[model samples]
Target: LQTIKNHLVEDMFASEGFRSDLFYDVQTRQNIVDVVKKNGKLKVNDATMTRCDLLNTNGVIHVINKVLLPDHHIED
Candidate 1:
């Protein structure tokens, strides 16, 4: 799990869409980590999240889990 998280973080930083203010924000990073912990997955499809396809610049993909991840409010 730690490995996956690291990979995601690294990728995010390397991504062109990454914004220093948004991506490096401790609160936002912790929120994403919390979501992964509680739901065993990341809610990549969230409006606030960004996605991109390396193979196809014209397309993008979000990394979502089979199950919905809960937010800080515990809402599903």
Candidate 2:
């Protein structure tokens, strides 16, 4: 759906990537790059990266354990 498409950002696979992009909240700021790099696994914020590089008609989907919100901040 067009609504879904607008909600998603395909920059996760970009050269610089959207790992630690900051977002503004109520005239405040937050760091939404709480990504965790373990052994070889990646977890963004509190959502663990379950899958990646999935084939989608529109774009790729990176599965995660939790539903990520627009809150800024990511684990270092």
Candidate 3:
């Protein structure tokens, strides 16, 4: 369950386009993922982001189609 919760990022996308190779998740502060907007679509790592910037009182929400496991958490 903790792995799932770490998928939520601490930052919010305030614009329609952005790119970063060092975005940290809510948990596992040492873990990082890249966020990029390409061909008008948003992506996290190689996973496509189906939804972006769903706003709420707390923060923003973005949905991706694949599981983003931290490097240390991946099985060999």
Top candidate, metric lDDT: 3
lDDT of each: 0.33, 0.49, 0.61
Write candidate 1's Cα lDDT for 17-49 as tens digits.
443323232233224432222222223323233
Cα RMSD (Å) per model? Answer: 12.2, 7.1, 4.9
Ordered list by lDDT, greatest first: 3, 2, 1
Ranking by TM-score: 3, 2, 1
**Higher-ranked by TM-score: 2 or 3:** 3
- Per-residue lDDT tens digits for candidate 2, residues 1-76, read 4323323664435212433444211211222345545555666655567777676777667777775555534543
Clash pairs for candidate 2 = 31-72, 31-73, 32-73, 33-74, 34-74, 34-75
lDDT for predicted candidate 3 compared with the true structure: 0.61
**Cα-based lDDT at residue 28, candidate 2:** 13
lDDT of 2 at 15: 19
Per-residue lDDT of candidate 3, residues 1-76 (tens digit): 6556558656666537464532423233346666655567766666788887788899877777888766533211
The segments of candidate 1 whose C-alpha lies over 4 angstroms from its true place after superposition are: 1-14, 23-58, 64-68, 73-76
